[model samples]
Target: MNGKIIGGFLVLSALVAGAAMYYLQVYAFYRPVEVSSPAAAIRLVSLGGVQEAMLTSDFEAIDADSSPLRFRGCFVTPMTLAMLSETFETYEDPTPLNAPPWFGCFDAERIGADLETGAALAFLSEKNIHPGVDRVVAVYPDGRAYAWHQLNESAEK
Candidate 1:
């Protein structure tokens, strides 16, 4: 009876270990993606109408003309993407929903950061995202924009 109990325990342990490994390898690791440049993002949005580039650390993206309610759209950087992946490492992917799985954690206000843009750009280059700089486009009221240009695999989210 003792031997049977030990055998059952071992089998349970193995199953648990296997599940842990699968989650760690397949889901936990951050799979870096190459995001498009801010210049490109600007250009894409400009196709609809003239758009402005906001990358300096001194000022946040905003429209002084009106009471800024929300950003119309966002041009996410590779570094920012990495940050999000790390931030939501354990978050369950909101699948079967049409919206972005990780959008829940994204804050548009954070993207206007000029102070961290420099550091973030450096990190982006190391991750193989070329011309790592402020590839930021903040959509304000009356601002024209394009669809989000992400380089990561959608299924991963």
Candidate 2:
């Protein structure tokens, strides 16, 4: 009778310990941190004469101007892609933040092309403009355009 009671108590304690370990691993260890920021927004002019806008950070607060369409997602322009790839590689982590499974394709050459194209697009978009081809244009935020051009020229290798 004594032996049977001791065996039952051991089994019960083992089950409780296993349950606690499972709970901790599932709920406490694998959660991702929430992101907050300067609030990135993207506005695009589609080829069909439609203007699309997207807001990141808090996607629920989307509003559309003119058309009844609104978007709530991050833009993956060339610059952003290059930055993300570089960040991931710099960290030397096999897995990167918000990276897709096939992110290995973003080598140095690909990142350079993406950054150049993205920078051009960003410059045009700042002035509510768009470029027909992938070319760089220097723009200043405070309506002084010459500074960026001068900087770019000086930085050229």
Candidate 3:
């Protein structure tokens, strides 16, 4: 009877720890990013290597202090793809990071697939936003856009 009690206690303790870990990783650290925040700006790197703010609207974003890669934003841009491509430096590789499911606007898998098929184009928002991490924006032809922070080549090296 003592052994049974000990085994059940151990199992319950393990289950509780696992649940707490999941909650902390997926839900605890993130916070809604306000429009007034600098992280909310939808800026792109110009051909001249300057970061310029683009005209964006309906912006909704979330970020976490825990990691630079935790930023994810969804917005609408009035700028056409043609104008942007001609003006901004295109990001050769844009890997969207997964956002917590509660933040429904940003979908990393869909954005990544769109980029791969040329359904969307990725541009450098800001280089080295956080040491080796960069801010990348991916836009569809219809002006639907998303942004996320990813590790740059320097970080990889």
Rank candidates, lDDT, best first: 3, 1, 2
Candidate 3: which stretches are off by over 4 Å? none
lDDT of 1: 0.29
Candidate 3, poorest ten consecutive residues by summed lDDT: 36-45
Residue 148 Cα positional deviation in candidate 2, in Å, after optimal superposition: 35
Steric clash pairs (candidate 3): none
Better of 2 and 3 by TM-score: 3
- For lDDT, the strongest prediction is 3
Q: Compute each candidate's TM-score over C-alphas.
A: 0.24, 0.29, 0.98
> What tens-digit string does per-residue lDDT give for candidate 2 at 1-157?
9989999999999999999987653343332222332213333333343434422232212212321111112222333423322332111111111212222322323333433553312232121122212111221122111000011222233
Alpha carbon lDDT of residue 139, candidate 3? 95
- Enumerate clash totals for all models, in the order shown: 3, 0, 0
Give per-residue CA lDDT, model 1, range 20-87, as digits (tens).
98766434542222234232222211222333232322121211112111212333332243432233
Task: Name the better of 1 and 3 by lDDT.
Answer: 3
